[model samples]
Target chain A: MRTALCSLLDIEHPIVGFTPSEHVAAAISRAGGLGVLGCVRFNDPAELDEALTWLDGNTDGRPYGVDVVMPTRVPTEGTAADLDKLIPAGHRDFVESTLTKLGVPPLPDDDSPARDGVLGWLHSVARSHVEVALAHRPRLIANALGPPPPDVIEQAHAHGLVVAALAGRAAHARAQVASGVDLVVAQGYEAGGHTGEIASMVLVPEVVDEVGGSVPVLAAGGIGCGRQIAAALALGAAGVWMGSCWLTTEEYVIGTAMPALREALLAAGSSDTVRSRIYSGKPARLLRNRWTGAWEESGAPAPLPMPLQNLLVSEAHRRLMESGDPSVVPMPVGQIVGRMNDVRPVADVMATLVAEAGETLKRLGELHP
Target chain B: MRTALCSLLDIEHPIVGFTPSEHVAAAISRAGGLGVLGCVRFNDPAELDEALTWLDGNTDGRPYGVDVVMPTRVPTEGTAADLDKLIPAGHRDFVESTLTKLGVPPLPDDDSPARDGVLGWLHSVARSHVEVALAHRPRLIANALGPPPPDVIEQAHAHGLVVAALAGRAAHARAQVASGVDLVVAQGYEAGGHTGEIASMVLVPEVVDEVGGSVPVLAAGGIGCGRQIAAALALGAAGVWMGSCWLTTEEYVIGTAMPALREALLAAGSSDTVRSRIYSGKPARLLRNRWTGAWEESGAPAPLPMPLQNLLVSEAHRRLMESGDPSVVPMPVGQIVGRMNDVRPVADVMATLVAEAGETLKRLGELHP
Candidate 1:
């Protein structure tokens, strides 16, 4: 398990867990792997600071990373209110009608502050996140969508943090290397959230070839078990950056959505998911449910561009989550969900991956002998 | 290269090449690998018999195979003539208008018979092909689209030929195993021709797990070079089955279409391909040329169902190939086109894959040491 990536990140194994939960992140780091907390959900700088401070105290001096969503080109050019106005009326009508058709109940009439600002898809908000993340003692900072801006990469380097970018294509990996990234996370189309059409088997080696000897490459997408970890290393990746596998970890607390998500993932076959723009205005893999089916059905309106699409669906997602309907809840997961059948502790998951990978490596060595 | 699959197939290497040309197939077989001749184009039983006879004499006693496109579910339930009539007028009009709009000149009217019957999308024609192939001495028989019918599998076994099926999903692989397929080719979305949405990294292990020692699995899709082969074996595949890499081999003679096809492949990046139903009615990954782009552009008609779509585009494909126009040529390729930068002999390709995979395995071994 201790490869070059392990030495580079000072971890016992070359596995990095990406999660939104502080508990899972701290547990993975304490279990001898780097735990990267996804910070795109943290809109307020003070809240992000508090979360990092808590992680520092909980991890017992182990190193962890932070992941932010910062696209090189923001879809809309305006303030939050102005961007909200750019969403098409047809899309809103479709969302509302589909939810009504799905028999989703309306939210209770209570005065809660609008949670729109907390959804971070804007460049300004992500930049603020980078500012807060750099203020903390993290070993790595990764941008999920595209190459981090040059000044941000420079600033992160200046703060002695490794700058990482996720790319779904070889050309994008080259661009990230040119922009001075310390690591490139080559994700495949089967990955959850935003991904390009290239799969992990193709993208990893292409990105490794494109970057040449400049920076280490981390394989992402469709990586859950130990055999996949071994495959990633054989594809010339320095490590594996996994996110979907962590969703079912015992420490992953998604409030009311946990039970339904776990059940959906357990019941899902490999083909049970689809890549659609209904969730984020970009083609992201999500478990196929009534919500995704409604958007893809005939006569459904085309999803709007990002940020606007994210904003339009945010309310619907909230209502669905509150409704506790597993059939309609928005679950972003990778194709590897087919393998995530059980809810295990973070330490157990790490041990299984390491042990299985060790066994796979030994078996492969016997092939030549 | 001497894995269980190599011994099972009696090949020196575990590499299998799928090509439409009998010359390339014989060359690959002579190169100590299994060469499978794609027989979908040989709709006439006599023509297929002639081709297999040619392959037998040319391969120098090396064992070769035959691949047929026998989709488990026929899209249309009718005789060949009835299915031909089922093609809509709108699809024909769209194809003609698009080809004319692209300035492709009409074919010269020589008294050559309308060779349209040569295309085998109908179950009857594919069954005829299987009958013709079984009359020969092929070591293996493979179904490209789905599991071969149980009778077909039984007949192949009766003839002492190995039965293999290509699966894009784990469930499909399990179905094939249940149908008594001897080998499962777990193809990913990045594979050329018809493929499902699951990528190889996730699909291979899932398929392997599903079969659970019932049959060996061959990793397909995005496999071009040696490192990818190593990655496939690491993912627990017994061998590597490749199609797109052979399209650029020096012996691949598509007449005048070869130069333009090779140029397009060399210039393509990994993201330049899209999975579309324009070519074969099923979503197959193809190079993004003007032909594919026109079908997907705004105001374009949705592609018709399988045999209908294949019928509508057959004439257009013939004209494009005859015209030698690279921009509008219909080329079925995979994302691995990014790595097919040169046209080498079949022997050299095998040698490179073996050498590169050997080095990769050694490097992986050193990681543990």
Candidate 2:
């Protein structure tokens, strides 16, 4: 399973597991693959610092990375309070009404402030994430949207951290390389979260053709099993950058925080996902649930732009997660959902992926040996 | 580059070249790959019979296949004239107005009747295609939509011809195998013609897992180069079924029927395509042009059902073909259009695909060996 990426990233296998859970991140790195913790969910820098400290202690000296959501097309940046004002009343009403229709119960009123979802998406907060990540022993920092800002890239390099960017097209990959990123993750349309129109079959080779010698390219989107990993490598990707596959892992967000979401994901087929802007004002592949379906219905208010859209529906998303209704939450997942039918530990998943990929590569090699 | 598909199809490489042009098909078969000629373009049985007869003599005794567009959900079965009446006047007006806006002039008045595009999409006409194909020496008969209705399968089998069907999902492939088709073409969303939501990265492996040992799966969609062919085989497909790559071949249409279309295609990138229902009643990927863009605009009339949509726009399509305005024609193409930058002979394309696939497989085999 080793490739040029294994050498570059100093991992045993050429796999980068992406998850928001610190537990999963540590497990993946400990299992000899790079685990990238998604930092966008942590609106507070203190929380991210705490999570990184925990990852540092648990990964047994293995290398790991962190991912942040910094929009290439910079969105309106401000405090969450200032950003919330930009959301329209109609959009908020649609969310509330759609939640009522979906039978999602409201959260119990508490003195603790509601979780702010849009802050981390803004440029300022993402820079803070870069700062917090730099203070840790993380080996890499990845941007989910596109290339990180020039200053951010410079800062990461100064801290001896490798900068990686996600690109959906060859042109984007070239631009990311030109902007001084160390590597490119060619995330395709079938990938969960933010994605571009090209599929992995086309995007990976195109990106590799554009930047393979200059920088290693990791194939993302719709990659789960070992065969997919082999296919990605065969398409010229140095390694595989996987996210959706880890959502169902035992360490994913742990406990009851997203049991309903996991159940819905387990029951989904390959065609059960939809690419829409309803997730964060940017088009992302999400599980097709009532929450996503309602916004697509005729007469439904069009989703607002990023930051504002996430702000408007943050409470609705929270309530849906807590509602215990599997059919209502719009969780990000790839078309690989069809194969994720059971819960497994991160080590077991990594073991199976490495074993299968080795066997597949050996089998394919025999074809022309 | 050989696989089980080569043995089954009696070709040197596990590649299926699908083209609507008989010249391209014959050249492919002569070059040691299976060339499957698309039969849906020929509405009349006599014309198809004539073309297949020419193919029989030109292939140097090599085997080829024929593809027909038989909709699983049966459409209206009637004469072209009878079916034309069912198209809404508003839809006709929209097509005419769109043509005028695109600077597509009407064809010169001729004594011959107008070409009817929807007839071949109907059940009766496709069945006629099967009849004409069976009369020829084609080794395989493929249905584009789903499994040829059971009788069609039985008819092809009775004639000693293998039957193959295209599927976009695992379940669709299972159904095709259950319906007794010998092979399944797992076409993905990145493909040129009518496609489902799943992409080749996910769809190919899913289909192979569902029906691989039972029957070989031919991976299609976004497959243009030998590297993609290698990746498809790595993903468990027995072969690669290609369509868009042939559009830019020297023998694509012959003469000057589509010089402008070829130029536009050569200038296209991977992201320069959109999946829309404007081509047929079903969603198909088309080169992004002013014509497709116009239909996507607000207030544009919703495209009619399959047969009706084709009937309403058949004349417009013909006029656009003759108009020499490349930006107006909604040509079916995949994201692989990015790589099709030059026109070459079909033999050169076949040789490159075979050579590249062999090198790629050899390179991947070296990773572990």
Candidate 3:
């Protein structure tokens, strides 16, 4: 019932669910663990504010977090005024051409998505959002890319918000700790988006070793069960960060197409998931399907820089959602899909995971002579 | 120019170097694309000797084939007359102690200068050795377990042979794969080693995929290079049949590490290495190492059944060279690794791959534009 993770977040469970949907985020937070919304896709601070406002009503004061990717070095964030100047003609041309091929119509005029947004590449734009987001009463702020900039962490600390950064490898966790983030998430390759080489098992303990308890470590990637959550704690992770598991839940507003794709993947007990920059510019785990397949074919232009690629895919993402064709689509999830059997409600899933983990721990205790 | 794999046998190259050694099987064959070895470590087999031997000395004796295994099914070909009647008491006692303690002696046998005949796992046995190797006049028979199987494939095919296997994700080429083999080798995780999830760019396509395609798909993990192999074929793979590249490789080593590691894997990168024995009773790749570590640390009986638990790492294969040491390790090879960067080894690893393949008229090529 009690865990160090819960103590860190002041919640009942160490399960921190990462998602882009406000509905799912609120449900997870209300269920128990904090729900951190992925901020890579949000372009405007107002939009994030709206989502947070909705989350506020849904969570009823439960703790939640915001995840932003603050990459090591971003080109788009070059200067105060010349942010868009750095993108080259060829890259821009490639983006335009890619969108045409994917069938996503061009961005609408005044109704179009913002032109200056970072497109999930961890640009200066993401940092701006972080500043605006910290003003809210959210419990945590996580950097999904590299460590949060010193200013962001300092400001967050100043604002009384716990800071976290996602690490795919152990060294990254150490980097997060040294950078002064309050927590480090050991995100495994099984995770939905950007991740490092190490698995949760190897990665968690390694991160634990590297951080040496200076910061609480949350095990991300394939943590979808009570036993898995318990395992994260057992391996020294203060919390378990889950993403895909929540996407299939009842509250998720995403179409059945994506979940159906995930279900097909679940049946195979694994996925043909490969990390490609075809969707978002950075390497993110996605089901291996036609879009990625197209990128993989010979003579294809190598994916361009972050925001550019995101720019290219954004229209297509909308079109595909409208079309509901999975052959040309990818449902981004973690390797945990294999273990994520049937669909379950967020509350039931959380309860099952916790109860099963308790039993596993008890069984584990019984193992001792 | 002649090869046991090509003009003689039915394959396309004269280079036949079969190995459990990730580096050798990958290196030599990738070098010439004539590599064909054992898949036992990856999964169980149905008397591979016939197929292996059929491949032997075929390239008018250019060289070919490696025979391997974790062990067997039905009554194991070795041990007591009756199956269940045979649990060696001392062995059982040792296993019980080891399992209960969750302990394994450090690589003492490895450090020992006279570690001879200690026989790791099972490949050390003579009865099983001749059973397979003698059947094939392999250009080479790579035995990854230990002291190359007695009378190795080269000897049966009448010498002037090339025998090799791999060693280490750790140290570089040593008195290792070369001592028993004609070629000296080393495969980092970049290689698809025993579930090989190492890096080839770092490993190879470093060693060969590493320093020179001029070296050889004889290139490992991330190989089948044209530009890369053109970089590795230029570096090396006179011929290559890289297993994982072949699992996706134009061949079949299917159902081996599938259910255990690759099948359960969320993302398919050389980075997802979970060397656990939940498969083949050895610690192979079954997702992240953490998954297996749980079953391992559980108070279960130290795994049993060859290819059976060989898939789980829960037990050790008794009569097989691939088992033992706290449990059989997963027998997987790396894909060209990242250097596998591309997936066209069958065609790209060699200039010959395309031209020769083009000439074959397999009824399928006519369809390609």
Candidate 4:
């Protein structure tokens, strides 16, 4: 009844459910697996505190983790002499003109959020969010892009929390382990949010071989079933970390537009979705749409760096969120959307995946050994 | 500066590629555009000889094509299926043993003078090939995956010919498409054969839009690349037809690995890659490898099928091609691998994807209000 992964994380199953909502995270934990709350959008310190408080009250003492976006490169992390001096105005203008052509209207008069530039916003939110998450005793903290910043990692270990980071390739996995991360997640493109080019089938094994078990690799991206969960362990993964499968669950708060788009995705071939910075300045896969079309218009300007470009598109996203229009909105999702076909409770979803994987393993075990 | 793809086929550009290597038939032909070749390992007399002769020799040498398996697949489709199928049962052991325990042997004594199946000995010979080339008159035939099937499409089209087939995705522009095809290529996972899954990177347009006026659509597996290709044409595509991109890649080929594997696959994510052949009966991008490893074991049964499974792997496949060792055999080649990284070549490979699409038509003086 025990899985190597469950043993690794001291849980009933090695499943780590990834969701942007605190409710789903707590529910998964209560269901006897780890719940990872996505914190990429938690731009304020107070919000992190509130989410943790909510999770604490709801989980009834179950374990959970938190995820944050600590990208490979922070625009502001470069010393004044590093990038600020090297990148020129022409590049910046080229970016401006590009967004302008894409119908990126000027910042509206009613909003005054994050006046901070790209570098400033990244630094501020990343720092405050990590600090806030640490305040609560989350079992793990995963950095969506890279290993947690050194300071963050130092603080987490000091508090007995394990640190994990997402890696899109073999090289990235090596870097993550060298940074002393507790786990390395080799995320396949099928994952929601941001991911890389390799498939889970190939990437996971390559990473396991590369990391050589120095760190446990929890496979991420498109892992939604028992068979896949079994395969990950067969491929040497200690656990399976998922995101999209949770999107349509009852505990997920995805709105009408997203749910509708997600439904349409069920009929699509896996290749139908695309990864474009049009959603965030960095590439993240989502359903293709007209808003992406306009921004991607042939010679459209380059998207500005992370937070700035994200800031510009945030308005379009807000409008779409408000209007529920599929035509001009950026739906943050992954190739795994094709698999999130039904609405189930987070607990049911977890149980089904684990149960299925166990059956698959048993069947495999029945085979010639 | 012109490619045989353009000059020979008389298409706007030389980007012709990814056609099934059948004897050339459609609901009929010239859908106004053309489809080339990908990874096809099987060949009956009617198909190999007839398909090539017709695609290249007929069409007024207009610009149609044929593709053969690279020197890999059956290495020598000429292997004796009858005798090979008679191998002892012990050789088919993997079916009775665990994969980790299978003892894959070294390469066999490959002294045969056959031209087809696997290593493509037929292609390595130039005389029988030159005569074959002269037999057909096609425009442009290419050689990759170890030189296109001999007599290639170009040799015939010269009597008038326009031929092209699939290539590796990394070669999307620089290598695969750059050298020349009258057309270019950018295939994604939804494809068959051995493939890598990196969502077309908006690759269709990157290649289509980037290679502007150079080639047209021939989109591959996932050509069910659909409204997306509508976007492709918006990005610019002459036409679109797909292969595994369609299970019935024209419907002629469908096999047993059906139902369970297929259903399992439907429930699978883009992250899935079954190097096991729930299909090839061997283990290909199948549901799992347990079945495949069962065959690769040292004392397992022999493999059957094209070129005789190339070795003794299973009762079904094992009886077909066991010369001694298939572990030393060549693997299949299809452009779609699973998504190890999220490049989404679909709409986002390059910035010029759409604009240049406009520019391409503009330069061609084909614009409309």
Candidate 5:
């Protein structure tokens, strides 16, 4: 685990965990790996500020990172209200009809204004996230989609923070490196959230060969255990960036509307997930259920692009989550869900990964003999 | 490079080349790596026998192998003529109209019966390939589509020949191992010909973890260079099985109707190919061309199942090759085509792979220190 990445990030192990929970991130940082908090869910800057403030006080002064979803292609321009008008009536009808037909109930009548302006795919919304994250003493900031803007990278560097960008293609990795990103997270198709068509095995080595000389690459997608970490290093990746595996961690299990998220993942197999655009208007891998199937089956309308699609399904997702139906929950997960069969603590997961990878390396060392 | 595969296969290098040419296979075997001849092209048993006889005389007693496509799911049963009738008239019209619109000329008149009986996907045709290959003193016999039939595996083993099968999924690998396969080639999505959606990076380790203890696993798909071979080994592959890289060799460059195959491959990048069922009714990766575009564009008819789809486009491919048009040539290649940029001999390619892999291993060895 003591590779260049260990020294670069000043972490004991070359493993980076991505999660939305502050507790999981703190636990991972305390366990000697970099814990990156996914800040897209924090629509309000104050919420992100409070989360970062908590992270700053915790983790025994260890460094953590923040991930923002800043897609290169903004399908629509203007405010969220203006974007809402662009979503077609037919698409809205289909989403509502499908959810209603599936018997999904609506959320309880609470006075929260439906999370209107905080859609993370909006550049303006994500920019606020960067602002909130920089207010804290985090060491790294990663853009979830494509290369971050040149100014964003410069701003992060000016603040003494490393700027990392996720690339699903070798060309994207090269573009990110050219834009002065300090690190490239080469994500594969098997990964959750947004992804390209290329798989991790081919994408990692291709990106490593393309831009690895200039910037370190973190192998992502379907990375759950220690042997995969070893494999990533063999592919010339500096480390492994894992997100889906942490979703089932005990820290993540503590909060959230759906306690069945971990149970759904445990029950799923590698082929049980589908890459569909219904989640966020991008081809993201998610658990195959009525939602994904309805969007793909015959007579289903083509999903609206970007922010429009995300808006159409956001309320439905809220309802499904509140309903607590594991089958309909909007869980973004990777194919690695097939391997995450247990509910363990972050420390136990990290220890097992490190030990298994150490043993795998020792076994590989004996291959020649 | 000195893994158990070398001793098990009695080869100096744990690299295997898959090619349709007898010359390339013999050249590869003589260069210290096993060369598996793809027998799907030989519709007649006599043609395969003739090819094997030539290999026997040329290889200096080195071990070689044969590969036949025996798909688990047969789209339609019956003879080629019987299956030819099953192809819809609309698909035939589309193929003819698309090719004519592209201005592809007809094949030069030769006295052969237009190759009507030898559809590769048909099990009856593939079984003849097996019968012909068994008559030769080959070291291994591999089934391309799925696990070989029980009788096929039993027969191959009884002759002291190693039985191998390709798998794109972990479950497929496990099934192949359970069916008594001596080796499982984990072909990823980036591979040429037929492939699954799982990328080699994630798929290799998954398949390796699933079946490596039961039998050896060979990593295939996007493996064109030595560094890739090193990565494959790092992913726990016993050896590397490559197909697309050999398509650009000098031997392949000669005696092929389309002299531009190598040029096309050299001009291609990793993203230049697509996985479409237009070629074989199964989602096989191919260099994107006018043919692939015509089938996928708006108003295009959905491609029929296996033999029917293969039948729909066979004549058009023949005419394209005979006309020497690169745009319509049916070249099944992997994403590694981007890395294959030269016209070298089989021996030089093998030597460079061995040397490059050695250097990569040494470089990785320094990563810890």
Candidate 6:
């Protein structure tokens, strides 16, 4: 399964595991694949720095990556309080009313800051994520939405870090490569969270053709098992970037903190997810649950654009998670949830992927032999 | 390039080319692959009988197949006239007004029966198609929606014809296998025309896991080039079933009859299509154009159910074709349209697919060796 990606990323396997949990990320790096910790959930810079420091120690001297979300077009810069005021009153009311209708209990009053309004999706916060990541020993910095700003790319290069960007279209991949990204993750429509309308089978090759020679392409979306990884390689991708498959991994923070969500994902089928804008005001794939269904009802308010939509639903998302009801919680997962049928340690998953890919490649080789 | 599908279907390559033209079907069969002629476009039994007769003589004694559209559940049986009457007046007006707005001119008066109301989607019409196919020498009979009815399956088996069905979900494949289907075409969301929401990468392995040992699985959707065919095999499919890839083949009817439509397809990219119910009451992927755009506008009437919706838009489709304008014509195609950039003979396409798959397999083989 070795490819140019293994040499470039300094990993044993050509698989890149993406998860928001620092624990899962470290385990993946230790297991011989690149583990990219998603930094968008860390609204506070100090928290991201702490997580990266933990990863640096736990990875046993192996390389890991950090991913941040920054829109291709820089959004309006504003403070959390300023952005909060921009959310419409009606949108807030709709969220409150929907939560009440669904009987989602509110968070218990505590001194801890509410984990609402994931301000990390904003450009400024994501820039800070890059700043924190550069101070660590990570080897890669990935932009989830588009190419990192040129200055950020230059800074990462100065620190000898590879800068990769996720693209849903061939044009986007071309744009990312032109902007000096080291690698392109061709994330398809079937991927979790924000994605373009092209599926992996078509998108990977298109992206590969667009930028494979300049920058190795990593196929993503609906890729869970080793067969998919082999297929990705056949489609000209240098590697596979997987996310939703890790949601059920033992090291995933959600597996223990949100047992119901993990179970729901394990029990879901490919069709159980839907692409909708309710999650982030941008089109994204999410588990088809009560939250999405409510937003879909006739006369329901249309999701506001990006930051506003995420802000509007952030509290409701928090309440739904507190409710601990799997059917109502908003979870961003890919169609590959159908294949994540059970919990496994990151090492075990990595082993299975490597073994299965080897077997698949051997069988494919026999066809031509 | 060989698989169980090749042995079962008596073809040299594990590739199935699906097209509506008898000429294309015969060409594919002659090129060492199974060519399944889509029978849904033929409303008149005599016409289909003639087409099959032409295929019988033109395929150079090579094996071929016929595909018919039959919903899993039987709908109300009626003459085409009765079905046309069932279409709402407002739906008719909406179609008429939209066509007028798009400047699609009316067809010139001709003795050729109006090609409106594709009642072939109904059970009775599809059954008639099966009867016509059985009278011919096709090696296989496939139902597009689900398993052929039990009697039809028995009839096809009695006639020594293989029974195949297209399935979008694992359960659908299970059902088709249970109903004695010899093969399952796991059509994914990125496929042309009518399809399920699951993409081929997720759906193929799921279906293979469900019924591969019992019945061979053919991967469909988002498959155009040879690399995709190789990837399909990697995903555990016995072969690849392609539809949209054939639309630009020289033998396809639209190439000569509607050059603009063919040109539009050649120019399209992976993101140029959208899945909408406006094409047929059921959701089908169609080339995004003025027709689909009009249906999506505010205050536009919801598409009626399958038969009624087809009946409603049938005349509008006729007018769009007559207008010789590609931008307003309704063409059911897949995301793979992005790769169909040229016109070639069916033999050339098949040759390219085989050569590409062979190269891909050889390269993949080296990885493990």
Q: Share of real contacts kept by model 1?
A: 0.67
Model 6: DockQ against the native? 0.81
How high is the CA lDDT of each candidate model?
A: 0.85, 0.89, 0.53, 0.53, 0.84, 0.89
lDDT of 3 by residue, B153-222 (tens): 4463364445454543312333333334444233333344343333322233224322222212243433
Residue-level error in angstroms, candidate 3, position B311: 27
CA shift of B94, model 3, Å: 48
- For B1-369, candidate 1 gives per-residue lDDT tens digits of 578888889998888899999989999999988999999887577988998999989999999999988777876645546666877777778878988899888777982444363357778888888899888999999999888888889899999999999998888888888889999999998898898888899999988888948888999999988888888988889889999888888898866677777788878878888889988888988998888889888878888788777776777888877777778778888889888888899989989998888777777766663
Could you tell which candidate, 2 or 3, scores higher by TM-score? 2
Looking at chain B only, the TM-scores across the models are 0.96, 0.98, 0.49, 0.50, 0.97, 0.97
Alpha-carbon error at A243 in model 1, in Å? Answer: 0.7
Predicted complexes: DockQ each: 0.69, 0.79, 0.03, 0.02, 0.45, 0.81
Instruction: Tell me the TM-score that candidate 5 gets on chain A alone.
Output: 0.97
For lDDT, the strongest prediction is 6
What are the TM-scores, per candidate, against the unseen true structure? Answer: 0.97, 0.99, 0.53, 0.52, 0.96, 0.98
On the 0 to 100 scale, the lDDT of residue B227 in model 2 is 86
lDDT of 6 by residue, B1-369 (tens): 789998999999999989998999999999999999999988889999999999999999999999999997666668768777887788878888888899887777872556456889988888889989889999999989999889999999999999999999999999999999999999998998998898888999999999998999999999999899999999999999999988888888742346888878998889889899987788899999888999899979999887878877877777776677878768999999999999999999999999999999998988983
Off by over 4 Å in 1: A77-79, A115-118, B75-82, B115-118
Q: Per-residue lDDT for A1-369 in model 3, tens only?
A: 565667778888778889888888887888887988887767767888888788778897899988887787664544322545654666556555655676645444655543444454546668767866877778999888878788888999998899988887666677778889788888765577676665454456567768946887887876666656544554556667888788667676654456445445556333356777876677888766656776787656777676666655555665554445545555676666555667667888888877766664554333222
Per-residue lDDT of candidate 2, residues B1-369 (tens digit): 668988898888888889999999999999999889998888789999999999999999999999998888988777778888898888888888878777888788872466487588988888889888888899999989999999888988999888999999999889899999999999999999898889999999999999997999999998999889989998999999999999999888843548789878999999999999887888989999898899998879988788878877777777777778778766999999999999999999989988888888888888863
Clash number for each model = 0, 0, 127, 127, 1, 0
Superposed Cα deviation of residue B93, candidate 5 (Å): 0.9
How well is each residue in A31-85 modelled by candidate 5, as lDDT tens digits? 9999999988877789889989999998988889999988898657666677788
| lDDT of each residue in B245-341, candidate 5, tens digit only | 8888887743457466666778888778999988888899999887788888899998878878777787777776666767767789988887888
Candidate 1 local distance difference test against the native: 0.85
Candidate with the larger TM-score of 4 and 6: 6
